[model samples]
Target: MRYSYQIVVPAATYAPWLRDNEFLTLFKQVKKNSLVNFYQAYELWSLVEQLEKVNGDVLEVGVWRGSSSIVMGSKLKQLCSEKHVYACDTFEGVVKSDASRDNFYKGGEHRDTSQAFVAQLVEAAGLTNVTLLKGVFPEETGHCIESRQFSLCHIDVDTYISARQVMDWVWQRLSAGGVIIFNDFGFPMTQGITALVNEYRRDSDKMVIHNLNGNGILVKVKV
Candidate 1:
């Protein structure tokens, strides 16, 4: 049997307009910054637009209050036809990992946003193609997604074990020329994501790592 592999080099596009103007304007208008992170939003949107050009679906592993998901999913709906965006989260906050795993957050530190809240936000945004999968990553979450490939996957689980598990599950499902953006790449707190990326690169020649915003992106290209 022959295994197929491909790598993609992402074209990094900076939208200064979002930073100096649009995002800031929205930040003030909304009266809260809870749903927006300028850098993450801009970079993800750039990746989404590129993926749209090729007709691809989007998947996000961590969604808090549906802010980022709303942004990306809404844009995807506008740019592509019949393209789906899947958002997976426990909705009950991070679950306890095995004690051996590093970077596991002790209980009670993070807030758990309910599924109802996320659903309300998505509905208010009028996002049609967005699907919400409520559960932990790589386990209950895996059942929610079909076997279809994804053009872009955003992993933001924020811990080493969760990040690695999410990547391991999603990497092979990524289409040729798809991109996997790891949100906690070089951040000292999320060393597992960095370690996983390094290990993946050593095992595959077609993937390229682009470090951005304390995050690392693994782009798949056709070899």
Candidate 2:
């Protein structure tokens, strides 16, 4: 028997706002100064748009050079000024990558940043609603925000170990209708992360996973 599958593209995928000049301006601004490319930065802006509908705090794991964090903070300030964006990153780099699964990265791969540098970027952007946590997740930074609930969580750590750890930490704490965005989900280099996300989707009943470009969107269903 032949199996069939269909691709699902949301209506909002081509929303005019994503192509508007304002978004383009912000996208370029972040790309020019931050470490992420246009596609990744654009995805971050699109994900942040989900925050206008949800309620709770925001979190970003594996922030590199503060590009995505800045995008999130800027959007939150414009839409929900009361909410704070917690930017967590080792700034030291990608932790140890699973040698057998991850092909493109190694221990401390993207470690060309520091907490102070990101903090300065945030401050310079006039974003006061940001908290920068510098350290390994679920270890140093995770405990600090363990008691809080999140409406939006962005996980870009390019490893299975870190991705799984952050997922465990955030899934239960995610508010109803909250959105969790996973970066590099469709990339070949981080197949380990792809496996982790796939396993999670298989085991999860309350969560729905959608793929968009190089990202995975997980939205909590209302009970």
Candidate 3:
């Protein structure tokens, strides 16, 4: 008689359970009351866990009304003591994408937000460590962040040129174990993100791509 031996594996830790629960609760409470959407809230919760692990600064491009930034800032305050959260945006409605390029907002238009409005929301969130950078990304805004480095960078500009500019600007600042999440990766309309990912994959062997909620995440590993 022949006998086979089997090995048992222990259950893996559910890192996102608590965060998801909190997000779900928040979602239920604010789903109909706020302009902030559920998808953005979920993404905020997801990045919060990663930011906690790295204990570094959090940078977000295209902050609208400080919704996601507030979520990230709150988590950063609780998880890391020395880190700061920076939010960049024009504070106006979405800028028009390149006419020659295809992106999620190719034909669509976005409303302009005000810097004062965003600042008010940030203050309301009780986020003392949050810094608001008011301007368009990758242009006048690039000069504001010179030597800053981040552990978690969220790119949600919703256009090819803007997304590419954010990636190029933050790539060097991203820590080796940092994560860069693209908000429109899987959406076919955002060809710019798709192209960016393809180009990024060519040179990066440490990129872990994930498809979640029509978005794409590229988790970078330290060399």
Indicate which candidate wins on TM-score. 2
Mind giving the per-residue lDDT tens digits that candidate 1 earns over 116-187? 888987887778878899887778878767686788888877666777788678767887788888876665
TM-score of 3: 0.78
Instruction: Provide the lowest-lDDT 10-residue window in model 1.
Output: 1-10
Instruction: List the candidates ranked by lDDT, beginning with the highest.
Output: 2, 3, 1
Q: Considering TM-score, which of the candidate structures 1 and 2 is the better prediction for this target?
A: 2
lDDT of 3 by residue, 1-223 (tens): 1122234344665445456675666456434323435665676666777566674688888786667677777676766567888888887656648756653465334444667877877786677988999878778677877688778887877787788788888877887788887776655556666666656775653585745454567776763
Candidate 2, residue 13: Cα displacement in angstroms equals 9.3
TM-score of each: 0.79, 0.86, 0.78
Q: Please report, in order, the local distance difference test score of every candidate based on alpha carbons.
A: 0.68, 0.78, 0.69
The residue pairs that clash in candidate 3, if any, are 91-113, 92-112, 92-113, 93-111, 93-112, 93-113
- lDDT string, candidate 2, 1-223, tens digits: 0122345466765555555686677766667656555666666676677666777789999888888898888877777568889989988999857877676788887888888988888998889998999889978888888888888888889988888889888888888888888886767677787777676666544565646566777777852
* Model 1: lDDT to the true structure: 0.68
